[model samples]
Target: MTDLNVSVSRLSPHQECALHPSFKWKPVYNLECVFCQSTLCVRGMKAILLADTRVELYSTDLPPSGATVLVEEDYETRHCECRIKDIACALCGNIVGYHVMLPCHPCLKSCNNGHFWMFHSACVQPHERLDHNSNSILLWGSLPTSTQDDQMHSSDNLQWTECCR
Candidate 1:
């Protein structure tokens, strides 16, 4: 079983005790699969407003639909006016959370254009929530070719320092 201290909640006013106030609604770390520790999305992907203050919505370019298999069950919320599909880890098959597409809410755009993963905070492991003002670690994406040589060196140092300390 995943070493998740946080409990999953489907109800609104989600378990607030599990979240850090500073990063409660902010993308402050990578969202990883609780079962396999595989990264699903990173911090600062994009933010979306949801009706629930307890639930924070973030947009991910990580093949939102294709990567994970959706469960047979789905839910439609009148508040959001959208259909939600329960998404499971493609590898471990754990019910991570759900995603909504083309919701009626103004804050939430049509996810059909891209897609948004409404992850259950408990279902995801928040990695690298460290506060640093220095050269930000490259958690995802490739370094530009021009700065590749310099960045690789700096990235190694950053990782070592971050990991060790």
Candidate 2:
């Protein structure tokens, strides 16, 4: 994977122009829930400035601005719908959840189990998440569950980790 840039760098001026200087892109990894094996939602991406392809993580306590972070790849032009903004497992980049951006939120299990999920609303089915419904709800940092099987990060004392719904 490419190195990450967590610094507050200059927003890609080239983001507006088709012609511009070459900029290196980085791959951000998402964290998944141990229970239900679902990807949890997470704070939005924070753009940072850097000298080169190397990435330097800043304060983790900082909250991400809730917005869609664009990537080097075009969501509609460069790839198919699934490849556009598909979310992947943190441990493995498999198609775990859907998103309109790369490294979308964590699995749903993370949310339903009270685990912190990191995802953009565009990444999942409309009916699956409660935030999208007209219920006038806000479930960030909270788990999204439809069944009793949903459990937050499994116990550390257990011999195995739970990461599925």
Candidate 3:
């Protein structure tokens, strides 16, 4: 059994939260699995938007601790022939996403480091840490925006009014 060897440095909290410039969806820390509510990844992480429903995380960004990569079967993407492995929730064994094993040249050019982990939007949810010392969390389907219309999306099964802090 191959387990994800997580370095403690990868999970360290950031001094300040910095949102990705292109994607203003949410701050990239304290994301949790939608099914089991286990923490997927946290702190100082950067993401690339593969699609409206998928987000990609670089290998350096610390892949989800609660997920494991299954190397049993290799699959290719329809858009690109990049080989990938399925990523499953370590705790619940639910297929959460995929990890890129090999990237074609074109994919490498656009994929920054040529490798990343992709998570489905519905499979994972983002949470804001209200206080570093406290366990309080503010959960939302989407980031709070200036306009009420864009404050939350119903498909994510989260609402701005459901804050737990």
Residue pairs clashing in model 1 are: none
Clashing pairs in 3: none
Candidate 3 local lDDT, 1-165, one digit each (tens): 124221111211221133232333223345567897755544313456443226454232335332444646878877677887888766567877777788666775652422267666667776543322233332122223213322122312242223222
**Candidate 3: C-alpha RMSD after superposition:** 13.9
Candidate 2, 114-139: lDDT as tens digits: 11222432332222222223323222
Candidate closer to the true structure by lDDT (higher is better), 1 or 3: 1
**Could you estimate the TM-score for every candidate?**
0.49, 0.20, 0.52
Top-TM-score structure, candidate number: 3
Off by over 4 Å in 1: 1-28, 43-49, 57-59, 63-67, 109-115, 129-165
- Model 2: lDDT equals 0.27
lDDT of 1 by residue, 97-118 (tens): 7767545666454222233566
For each of the candidates, give the backbone clash count.
0, 36, 0
Q: Which of candidates 2 and 3 reaches a greater lDDT?
A: 3
Off by over 4 Å in 3: 1-26, 43-60, 64-66, 111-115, 129-165
Query: Candidate 2's error at 116, in angstroms?
Result: 17
Per-prediction RMSD in angstroms?
A: 13.1, 17.8, 13.9
